[model samples]
Target: MSESDPHQSGRGRVTAPARPSGKGGGKGVGEMIAIYDTTLRDGSQSESVQFSVEDKLRIARRLDLLGVDYIEGGWPGANPKDEAFFARAKDLKLERSRLVAFGSTRRAKVKAEDDTVLNALLAAGTGVITIFGKSWPLHVTRALGIAPAENLELIFDSIRHLKARTDQVFFDAEHFFDGFKADPDYAVKALMAARDGGADGLILCDTNGGSLPGEIAAIMRQIALPDVRLGIHCHNDGGLAVANTLAAVECGATQVQGTINGLGERCGNADLTTVVANLLLKMGRHARLGVEGLPRLTGVSRFVDEMCNRSPQKNQPFVGASAFAHKAGVHVAAILKDPVTYEHIDPEQVGNERRILVSEQAGRSNLVHKFREMGILDVDPNDPRLQDLLNELKELEFRGYQFDAAEASFELRVRKALGQLPEYFLEQGFRVIDNRMVRDDGAWIMGAEATVKLVVGGQPVHFVGEGNGPVDALYTVLRRALEWHYPAINTVTLVDYKVRILPQALGGRSGTGSMVRVLIEWRDEERSWGTVGVSEHIIAASYAAIMDALIFKLYKDGATPAV
Candidate 1:
């Protein structure tokens, strides 16, 4: 076969795992589910999500490393970027998954052989091709303004044309569940058309994303195709994408189509991170990645989020940061003794860690776990000093210092309490000047300029910086003074910053002097951390957080102070 031949295009093309012949109640590796990732296509449909060809390629490489079975690259003729992506993806050495081209069925009057859509799929040079067609009668008559019979013909001809060129052809029955609910016979006919035309897989899509678990299970059971691979693709419009997907699997669907972090149009698709974890750990079903790939699930989820320039949801199931976090005293006590008492699964199994959040509600157990999380070994958990630290933590929490959201700040305080933290720099003083200026547009604009004096390596240094805000100016000035002694500080940059004002009930004033809390999230090339500061003056509070963030970065990097 030629290099571009569909029969030999993919590096590794794996399909359904064999079903166990003997009826033993063992749910083992025999049930293999092919993971079809459409992050480069469907996920990009999300509002404000526009992945450049390079971004899609990078994500594809990352997904390959994470062991997805099939990667739906994109619709080759849909846009210039997607076409460019397919051309460039050919150069990538993606060794683990089959690359699939996605498109729609042939146009109403267009012949399948000469159809632009089918031709693009073939020209995309992928081993697998997936095309979506209207399964719902409403879409055939109303949306496409075509007769139901003609839509079926489109599905059949489109699949048969692509199947002639590609080794594997997948038919996505768009709105299959809703269509079945509307007209059972017509929906089944649409699926039958694809099957008759030699599609390798039949992917039933919950396009409207309104199907329930029971609905998916009942509909899947009705589609009794012998010797055919059934796939499930769900949307989260009804917040039941994951549930519906699991329901279909229980009803015998073998392939799963989704994005990395539940990213898609509207409410998003079923999160593959959640889906894969549940399949391997809870349901005993297997994906190509299997148990070995489970550990990188969290990393994969976060990698997609990073590519999207979005924050990973901390409360997301399975791989979320707070998935195994404990804050309540009672829960923390039990968790410290036995993690299984609270956590559904070991966090390490998914490349995530358990976090013990410290707050006013926290107890000694919270401190112990927090200490362990920071790798603070040799500390006596029963020591009286530990109680003192807990009391101090509670008092700080009472003063509106949220340690739970700012673990980096908590770690710094705990280290300092143990006399283990090194003082990286001493703040001499800082001044920020806010001025109103008239712009060329005849509008009043506000700007800030800050002067920071700091003693780094025992030498006093001063610097001036300007920005649109006081906090930015301060950070700019401070980073400059510190970077002189710690050049590595340049590697670190601010990721996010948040400020919250305490209410009057929390001992905060109503005016400009109101007590406020600042959270500064920082990131280096390696990892990200957040620090917190609280004070009546916003600038003072911001300075405290910035100082802690800089100190923590330097301390963690093991930078030696010149002093």
Candidate 2:
């Protein structure tokens, strides 16, 4: 190992020179890294990720719009859903991305044309096809029960067969990194076989995802094929997928494959969001996804989560809710002076915003900043009123009120404290009763009824309603009571409802007496807002949140009836 050689060190570690400022030609400042999104395919393999046929279509369109170079639609032969997705994709009007169909290489001793998986890939009607073959000799002998020499033949035969069918064929050398570590000659031979068989690109896969960055770069440098293009596919089992993928790129790999939000099997795959961000912002790569599409990165990440029915990870890098949120007083104060003081990148560059979170740790700067954003702009940063408001917020947070996700509720509280909130209605009282009866056939029937008394527009209004549950019954009666005065209530719809039992320490009690926090998401034709409430009684907490949601809607709409 010589100092002049960047590929090896005295300690047997692989090293690479600093990333070149210019390599693959593009408009950007750094080398171009092709963005290949497998969100619709590999992403759906996550434990909680299940994409409907429609979800696949929507995500494909989104990825195309985001300017990814390729969108892997999934293995068409694996399930009917994937087959249907491909069938439906024929009618899709994609602008930029090339749709690719994924499948394994030809089986042992089988002709590629005779393989059902290969036929399915052709039937998918995609111009591009990606077939993964076992690069590790161990997998060939153990998993496929084939001779190592025959495995190389399978790789060559599969790519040759597919090359005849399509002009663009990508060979995924599965477990390439691990296989290289075990037998470097076999791994290089497997890739060379694919290249010789007309593979346009050979993607080195960290299938087990245990390779370090140094190992990936060192091995990539050792590959002898200089003419064939290289790509990288990394899993996150070791939590180094992103680092390894970037290291491969730094070593001159032209393309990177990953899933949105890192959704995949086991620990998941490299997150395309993080990969693209690091490529463009950190490495200055001229990626297929340019600076223009970067702002929509956050929305794209959330859309995929919505389709998968998974909560967006707040701490996820680049696009998470807490990614740019400042909570500490010192941090908030510095961020107020200059966001770059605490944030690595401008949130708006990624279609996110810097958030000043107000908690017990909040300073006067936090209150002032949040107040201005909420349209309560008259408060001074050093005023006693701001201190009072901060004290109230801390006390409420002590009572399990999380204002981070319920900014509308927090605004209402501040307005009320400042005596700026209008009195829209007064609640007199509300009651709910539940009755259960068993029929002769041993079927149990449960019914709930709720009555609401309120003074709206100086008029006493009483209403009663029945529903499947107490909360529904209460909402029904409340809406009936307010419809005449506030027709806008008809436009408001409850989109989502969530409840969580606060921990005993936060709930200020134990057992059944502990407080339940309710978060309600409401949307009208214009926009959506979330409100939260906490109470020992679930119904009461739900009602409180419901009221807050309604009030927020009315306030936003400037609805001022003579109440």
Candidate 3:
């Protein structure tokens, strides 16, 4: 089969099935549930989420590649950024998913054709348009300040007008669940209005996100729309967004609207990654993304998080780093024999891997498994060296060295013990001087200067450098001194630096005297790795971590001294 074949399955590849041809008419009309992604729209509502026009376009392309059925770009009429995104999106050439423009229904006091919002939706130049309208009577009576009948007319007119401009018009019945609880008849009336007005699908939205799975399923069954397709949009306020979405699917909803990693306002929207996994693995439903797209789920999740400049949640469901990690002795032993003994599914199915974590909680079995996995040792479980390594690891953890977050440092320690580590350079000593003064431009500046002395090939070398801070200055001098011997060090960059103060009870007296743990993440062109250090002085701890990072990079690159 060709790479573009929609049925292919593999790692880091998605095979988007053909789009469904028909609209929602009744239960079981279509076996596939449309994965409508709102990551660019609702996801931007997350705190600290700010996507530029380029970011949105990049995400849209990624979602399309992930085989989602629809990608909701943004509210084109809301801001110039969104307008520019739509303008750029027109040239995206998405293969399977339809690009959608989101907006609210026309204002109650205006004609649909004359509404600037609807006009912008048309101007977005997408084939699909989604508009949210008030479903709750309270929103109509208080928020809109319009009569119930007038609200229904607004829903009808808005969808009808958009249907003329586009073949696909999805009506979002905002607060549908809450609206049904407050006034069932009126909520049903709103849905019916959208259905009668030629909406391709009527999405029941839990805007407040307080509805339970049972309540959502019950309400979905009660909604008697046989001709219109039903879609579900839920939030994570109640921590049941995925549950409620699944419940709706079970009750015959055919479309699922959600954001990647559940990014949204307040709690979040439904996490489409979780939704897709559950549907394909548990519910036995067919998706356009298909089982082929499952392996790329974790990659897509991390990619979205990276674009948002957020760390991937290590404990988040199937895709998390710790999802399949075993730390206990008994668990590791059982999993090594048969992973199904503990794991629900194969981690590789989602492009994740089983990891045996070495910690104080780990035992002989855990150590053996971790050693084998790390390619460090494959000796007997009762080997004395294994026990020694475990003891040393525990002692390091007691000193605030977190191997879990800094595996590279842990590996180096193991190599040193095995007498396999090459001494890249001998550090004689280093000194840093900080000077605080006002600049000529009246700006306050803290200048940091550092002098580093190192021995390479039995020859002493001294280097001096300046930076904005002590750590920066130290790294600058070190890099300048080492580049002559290890040119590959230039390719390695410190991508992130984190520090934490160990609790007084752990081992410290007061604020400045407290022991600090530093974790530095380094990335080269090929890969990224983290190293950790712990010491009483913050600068000392940072220096240790920085040295470990450089040594790890050199070791990985096989850098040797010049002749």
Candidate 4:
């Protein structure tokens, strides 16, 4: 590290003409800004996000379908799982993406040909290879304990060595942004070393994730190198990875390296989810992401989350559940009239839909919109019943019911108010018993039994079920009691059950007596829906949610409507 200025914005400097965004070059509207996905490598580095080899393969398949240009699988020999991934990925047969193998430049004392790291990269059997090397003078001197010149040789030798054996090679200038600020001349030299070594592209990394957009644009303008073929790899520690990447693009950088949902170590990497949408929709630029790929953005986002065993972020931009939801009465009314009034692009363009939430803030327009969405087509803005429905919705919301996440229950309520719902079955009450006993080994065994009596098709039915808990027992017995009458109920299963203690429901009671809210996600082969119930007793709350789910399923499956 040498000359530095934390406040220096690289302003007024002329930037070189932009190169083709991908190695397969083209310019203008037809040219694509290659999307380089590192989710299998970098995203797996996220805290608590460990992808199995199978998970990596699944994600790679999905990314290929989405038409990303490059997929960096992982460092092959860095770990056993990555090794397995590459071996398994050999048969992956990606249609749209070229598989990439990642590694570092040769170690300080090692020759490029003999370096175990480089050998492992070649062994991965990928068509493309990307290697990172120190760019900062301080890192060259301290981190590598070598002269700056020797480090340059290491980078050049590593790339040239791989280039002779492989088709294409890329150099990731680690800490390039920070290094440029410290010693602008040395950082540029690092990229030059890779270029001279026959590297296809030079990736500038904001390793510290602290660089601002102004700094990125300004620094990019300072790079006067020819045949730059630049790429930008940003991290999100400063909450500016997406912004910085876009800035670099504005200054002529082509390829963008990031992970899905911004998953990575520490704060995270640039979110390809936001980057892709902005590139195609906002900037009106092109990418290798296919013609139909843009609409599948939300599906890809959620699919990655599912593979990571993480829940989808509702408030995430573009593809989030709440991105298109309008709750304010004024906003909903305007959006209903013309989505352009409140939305940036059509939600369907990104594989999402608009939601008009019915709550205390809602008005006639919200109820009318929501009722129609639930198939109550007769709802009118001027109808008195719309007002009554709105009042009931508010009252229910006041009692701790959230309709947005639990739409099945909300749909059922709307149908009932519209006289479109008929009683499919009647509950004749239920009983649950809990038992615990100590075994000879001093271990305690626990069991719960529930007896449910329901009158279905005017016939009384009784069933007893056992489970590890009262709620499970109740659901088992109740679902069993209904399956005989409604055979379609057999496909319905409880996929997820969530319980929350709402102190506000008990007027600010935070103790054990606080009312509980239960939300259960039910799914069949076709689709899934969420149902909710709130009660002072957990068991009762569970029962209410379970019953609502069954009722909703039966109703949708052609249970006779009221005469």
Per-candidate Cα lDDT values, in order, are: 0.85, 0.85, 0.86, 0.85
Q: What TM-score would each prediction reach against the true structure? A: 0.86, 0.91, 0.90, 0.91
| lDDT, model 3, position 401 | 81
Provide the lDDT at 489 for model 3. 85
lDDT of 4 by residue, 1-563 (tens): 11232112222122443433433222444446889999999989999998999999999999998899999999979989989999999999899999999999999888877999999999988979999999899999998899987787888789889999999999999999999999887787788778778898889999989999999988887776554578899999999999999888776677999999999999999999999899888886788785479898899999999998989999899999999989999998898889999999899988888888878888788887877776667556687777788899888778787888898998888888877888988889999999898989999999899999888878888899999889878888887888777778888889998988896644646688887889999998888999999887888888889989988888888866221
Model 3 TM-score on a 0 to 1 scale: 0.90
Q: Over 4 Å off in model 4, which ranges?
A: 1-31, 290-292, 453-464, 505-508, 560-563
Best by lDDT: 3
Tell me the spans in candidate 1 whose CA falls farther than 4 Å from its real position. 1-29, 419-430, 437-469, 472-495, 510-514, 523-528, 550-563
lDDT tens digits, residues 443-515, model 1?
9999999999877778889899998899888988888887778889888788888989887666877877789
lDDT, model 4, position 60: 95
- Give candidate 1's TM-score: 0.86
Estimate, for each residue in 219-247, the C-alpha lDDT of model 2 and write its tens digit.
87666554567899999999999999988
**Which ten residues in a row are the worst by lDDT in model 3?**
6-15
Q: Cα deviation in Å at residue 242, candidate 4?
A: 0.4
* Candidate 2 wrongly placed segments (more than 4 Å): 1-30, 439-442, 561-563
* Cα distance off (Å), candidate 4, residue 334: 1.0
| Residue 463 error, candidate 4, Å | 5.0
